[model samples]
Target: MDAPGRARREARIATFVGLASLASAMGIGRFAFTPLFPLMQDSAGITLAQASWIASANYLGYLVGAVASYVAAVKAPLAARWGLVVVAASTLLTAFADTVARWVVLRLVAGAASAFVLIGASAWALALLARSQRLRWSGWVFAGVGVGICLAGLTALVVASVGASARWAWVGLGVLAAAVAALGWRAFATMDAAVRPARPRGLGALDAASWTLILCYGIFGFGYILPATFIPAVARAIVADPRVFAWAWPLFGFAAAVSTIAVSHLARHAKPGAAAGCSFIVMALGVFLPAVGTGLGTLCLSAICVGGSFMVATMACLQQAQRVAGDASGGLIAAMTAAFALGQAVGPLTVTAAAPLREAIARPSAVAAALLLVAGIALLWCEGRTARK
Candidate 1:
């Protein structure tokens, strides 16, 4: 192959490696707890609050890991590899813990480890790829999270179907994560040894506007995740056919894949603001349709729209943060990621909290969907202002 062809080929190969490993580390393991929540609650005999804390632990760990990994990447990409291995180990440990308390701790450890691996791999990719190609390539790399989500979701579907055998699902995910970690280690080693410039710490680029975006993104995180996590359960509650619930997640996975591609394409023409606005619009429609409409058809449509739009929104938010903050984009991205993590962590908990209201008025799922619509509107407004300015 010609030099250009060889470089392109190598970058593509490295990107796939980075994405798959990242999906295992960050996407599947970190978010898997959501779909497993109702199952784990039953199996572990835990209160909603306790289960919520376990979810929170993972997010808190992700926040810590993101910052730590950012620092570690500057010195060596191997830091990411170690982080992935640790997270995978923690995931396996979760399977051994019989008590809610122990599982929470394990999830925290897993979250931190996954964060370090994801942030480090992403930062390394950003630094290594040429500037002209970074945006699109980085989006593709980030798609690993979606890929992992699909895997975890599909696993949850299968495990949930087995009645009481769902514990094995956690073990399966841990093993999958570990395998991905091994693959990531090999890929990181193969890539050119390039070091990142020093990052100014202490929330480097965060400003008032950036903080607003973070809050908005947090809302998006919470809104998107509630549906993503519990759509299967919702399907079970509403659908006549129980098996239809099992299919919700795989559909979500497929939608996520499509959305990743769509968002990347949109980025080529529309600025981040336009992209965010478009995504939020789609998400709003998705959330409302399922809330007001009926049957599996609407449910699947909601999943497809929500899955695609939110993923794109996240990418657009990060892109906007990078554009607005320049050198400080790293910190801005980190903060937004933290916010996003916080939202996902809180989403299921919010559902549990709202459970009591189900008897009094509308269903909890409807309430959650309404909240998502509100968040989408907020995101659209924010993006519009950003574009105008």
Candidate 2:
């Protein structure tokens, strides 16, 4: 109720709201295409590989955007506020593009814009926190991805319920994203700013441990994304509820947010690698649940597992990299981000390869479950050994 306490509380709320809004716009909104891919492909008469390209194009743009923003020294605090506007506008434009080529270009632009918005907002959030509180605040801020994912999923359901066409869904998402952007703009505009300028640096500055961390992160990327990309489709296959398609993503997002917050606490007491390994174990269990259970509850549980582990491991890896690499945060962040994008790029192909097995196993969840379990085992081996040393 006091002045300083009230001020601090307000500041924290601003950061949380700003970060969450950015996540909804950039992290969740832009990436919704992955979950929506099957539906879009079916409606648009595109191939799976082509659908994959749409997703890839977005990430490719993200890489370019992140790099470009770093190089331009574009006043991140200022950029963060506006990036959401641009991203939202771009999301809306994606609705107008009719051809695949046009969609690709639009998505690419959207991706780049999203990167600027998210990275800028995140950097600002971290900078605002005291040094002692930075890591925990950053972890909480990162939970925006989960929140965004939930929003996107909820939107998808609403759009689907109206029996809207795929094109309409795209338009709806764009408009919704823009609306969220406006709210974000308002939230960050009047609040005190916290970001300071830092010049972009190259990855060569990263040490051996940093490189190891990046590689481990890449594995996490490859392992976790398969479920993220395919789980909705897998859910569609098992549960007959047309509504399941809409509900699946929100469920995933909700689970992801909860898991990120819960495991972040765990990260304080445990080795980061150990925490990551345990996360993967959970992911493996969640991804496979439906194949064995084939019920709606299984679908919800699977979402919980994948969503929770999705970013917890990512944050832990980044934190570990910062600790081990020291002052090489820029390079380590870049490497980890790049590896994650690459893992996501390869995820669909991995799922596609298991197509024949889907028929035999009677579920795609089975394949995803096996993949995550193997990934967890690898993470456990790495972490367990690292812990022993």
Candidate 3:
């Protein structure tokens, strides 16, 4: 192959590696618990409150990991390698966790690993692709999260059909994650050498627009997570049969994957803030659907809307931040990620605090909807202002 052909091949490899890393980190490590929550409650005698806490613990760890990515001097490749390993280990070990406390600790560790992998792998892959002038394929990297989600959801569906315990499901996910990590390990071998360390910056260094972006990202976190975390459980509550309800999460994942690619194409012409605002509006509608309409159709629509927009909104916001912040995008990205993590951590607690779990769903949904609307308005206003300037 010629030099250009080799560079393209390397770029494609990096994108695939980034995708697999995210699938292992976010899909298996961070979100596998969402689908399994109901199973743990049914088979393991775990309470809703305990499950909420477990989820919160994982989000908290995500926040810590986001912070650590900025402050720590760890190399991105090293972090991605270790993070993937830890995610596989933590996911595998969850099968052996007999108690809620054990699951919480394991989830916390998994969350941190996920954050490390996401931030590290994304940076490494994007840098490689940009250097190779293959930046257009960056969307393929983010699609991995949705693909992973789809795989996990499908695995859960199969496990549920087989009448296997959630333990077996976790084991299956762990094995799959390990395989992904091993395959992606070679892609990161030269990443650490290729990328230079980012210079540190103060919190106040970001301009007004960046701060607004961070706040909007936090709201995005709070807005989408309520549905993202509970959709499977909500579906289970509506339909007792696992086979029937299992489609919700995989549908959600499919929508997410498709939307990310679509939105990436749209973003070339449309303003990122406007695109993100539209996504937030759609997601808000999705979050409000289950509250008002309890039917299967409504649930499916809700899944499509929320899942479709969350990753797209994330890509838009991160891309916008990078464009605006230029060379100093690292600190801004970490700050936005930390804010997002904080929002995610708070979402589950709000649901748990509301009594009579079924009734409680509406309140959080309403709040999420309201937050998303506000965020959408804010982004639109920002876009308009930018246009006028």
Tens-digit lDDT track of model 2 for 115-215: 67755665555545543253566667768888778777776677666766667767777777777676777656765544444355556756666666667
**Residue 122 miss distance in model 2 (angstroms):** 1.9
List ranges where model 2 is wrong by over 4 Å. 1-3, 41-43, 69-75, 131-139, 186-201, 265-268, 287-300, 325-328, 351-389
Compute the lDDT of residue 254 as modeled in candidate 3.
92
- Return the TM-score for each candidate structure: 0.83, 0.81, 0.96
Count of clashing residue pairs in every prediction: 0, 1, 0
**Candidate 3 residue spans exceeding 4 A from truth:** 192-199
Instruction: List lDDT for all candidates, in order.
Output: 0.68, 0.65, 0.85
Q: Which of candidates 1 and 2 is the stronger one according to lDDT?
A: 1
lDDT of 3 by residue, 1-389 (tens): 99999888889888889888988998998899888877777788877788889999999999988888877845678778889999999999999989888999999999999988887788778778877987777778888899999999999899888888899999999999999889877767754425444445777787999999999999988888877888888888889899988888999989988898877775667877888888889999999887788778898999999999988888778777767876566667778888999999999988854465556788888989999999988998999999999
Candidate 1: residue 121 Cα off by (Å): 2.1
The 10 consecutive residues of candidate 1 with the worst lDDT sum are 356-365
lDDT per residue as tens, model 1, 133-195: 545776677677778878887787777667755578789998998888877787777776364
